[model samples]
Target: MQTSSFIGAVDIMSTQTATERPILHGGRREAMREAYPAAPQPWIDLSTGINPIPYPIPTLPAECFTRLPDPEAATRLESIAAAAYHVSDAAMVAAAPGTQILIELLARLLPQQRIAILGPTYAEHQAAWARGGGSVDLIPDLDDLPAASSLVLCNPNNPDGRIIPPARLRALADHLAARGGLLVIDEAFADLADRATSMAATLPHPAIVILRSFGKTYGLAGVRLGFALADAPRAAAIRTALGPWAVSGPAIAIGTIALADPAWLAATQHRLTHAAATLDRLLTDAGMTIIGGTPLYRLAATATAPDWHDRLARAGIMTRRFDDHPSWLRFGLPADHTAWARLAAALSGNRPPLANHPDQ
Candidate 1:
């Protein structure tokens, strides 16, 4: 049997290793099936903190598939995104399959620099930096930020779902700028409601680069569209680094229509707000203490997060658990009443408490 080597040193294991591991995100009905061959597919997947009710996908033009994306598609998408975010058209935006690629491109462009990343957050930032020959420092606290050449932060961080305030971020940017360092803020989840809280509009003192993902906000993860916002020169640098035709024609078409639709944006926010609150109350009533996060999802723990996750899985429900901090689990907000009921029932059942608190 042919087998592949581990992708990175992080997976170097002394013990036995598997041929392949399931990808961490939800929508893993097939993997779940492979793991438990007899089990039914999950009724609801609350693993990813994605907006449940996505912005309505409109009819695609036939030309989107027939023709290659024009170079102008990137420019038009940027213009539409600027209007939506209330930023300048000259802010310089570039789209890729997703923000993940954009991040990798950034890391590659600055390979010699030391990169500081906020901890217990997205693992890709570290992976991308390491892949590009950049050393990474995990900053658990804002004060721990090293004198690195670049910093990456995930606002309203993943898994934990805690929002780092905008003012604090701005201050950090100022500090980094004074030291001649750059800051990259991944605000993929902030669009659920806190759009105004983003520093993307300000073009602040520090060479701050903001990343926004369409997958989380517009529920277009499969579409694989994301953008970077930065000043003209910095944006030009990243653009030069990325080269041309980086974004797809379908992505450009969908993003332009979606960004221009205020009605869809407003409606999604309202639906997500209501759903997230309901999910929070349901988890809280089931005896879990809600730690953080906004209307899109909630982070909670009652000591038995792992056990609870397993129990929920057995009952055909899937939620997200953190590798770095096992005590915390994240649940994506359910879109409708049926999903909410399923999740509530899973939580209501009694389960044994965890023996040791991971956070402690």
Candidate 2:
């Protein structure tokens, strides 16, 4: 079923001039502190796509702190990651401190070439490639990808959750391969998306590089771990650029255990699914049209997004607002019953929480 089906339809219209629109912000707690110093205590942040309820970290051995990240342990982590992410083999996976770092590293590793990115997605891809001296183009259609030497896209894309099929992407990869070009697929939110939406299962493609985020799915963003999966040569090049001890010892140990835990993975999926449905109802009731987003976040549209953002901010509930699209707001799932209640109250102009909505 469509994620949008849970929400009611709302007509979104805007009358304000560009300059009159208020910028709604949410991400870092420090940013929240700066923007709304007197708003409320213990801010409820929904700005980021990272999971609010993080995985329970296992107790660490003392050696994880005192010892350098062992290569063998790192290798085992890679093996587990490959299995978890559905990549063809462990040899195809390269671990990095975070996918953000890999974005920059991969951009630098590539030859300066024209790049096309699937649009209105993550801003970092454009920024990273631009810094590497590659010309960037944001194209709306998948057919346009073959025109650029390098193509970058987020599967079940960020901000707006758009997932292109694996077969069509494989065709694009083949076209790029023939031209000696590259296809960078950021599967950052694929874990909660339609499982088939991921291209990892069809990997070992010479031209395609699949990027996965451990922290986003596992809720350990601070752990500083991510993976880059590609054909042998590209994976080798990425590893060389990242160098030794690239991921922290603590990260390796945690990742080894977490990546192998299928039971927790399944339960988290179910939990996020219900939470996303609940969020959709809340946003729709507040007069927003459901846009699209992965389970990690929901994008909604309304003429008064800025006003809603302001109201929520005043109540110390920070959500994501888009600069380009003044009518859009993206919300992350609330961490707990209290957060959910707070978000519902904030959206309703700080009224008492709706009694109908039960804790997930």
Using lDDT as the measure, which candidate wins? 2
Measured with C-alpha atoms, the lDDT of residue 263 in candidate 1 is 88
Q: Write the per-residue lDDT of candidate 2 for residues 186-240, one digit (tens) a residue.
A: 9999988777999998878889999999999899998999999998788888988
Q: Which prediction has the highest TM-score against the true structure? A: 2
CA lDDT scores, all candidates in order: 0.72, 0.81
- Candidate 1, 1-360: lDDT as tens digits: 101111111211111112233224456555554544543444577777677777778899899988888978788888888777767664566666789888788887756378888776777677777778877777787788777888898887775666777788888888877877778888888776576678777773446888888888887788888878887777777777777877778888999999999888888888777777877888888788888876677888767776777677666676776654556777787767777777777788666565644554
Q: What is the lDDT of residue 12 in candidate 2?
A: 19
- The list of candidate 2 runs beyond 4 A from truth reads 1-26, 349-360
Clashes of each: 1, 0
Q: For each candidate, give its TM-score against the true structure.
A: 0.88, 0.89
lDDT for position 182 in model 1: 78
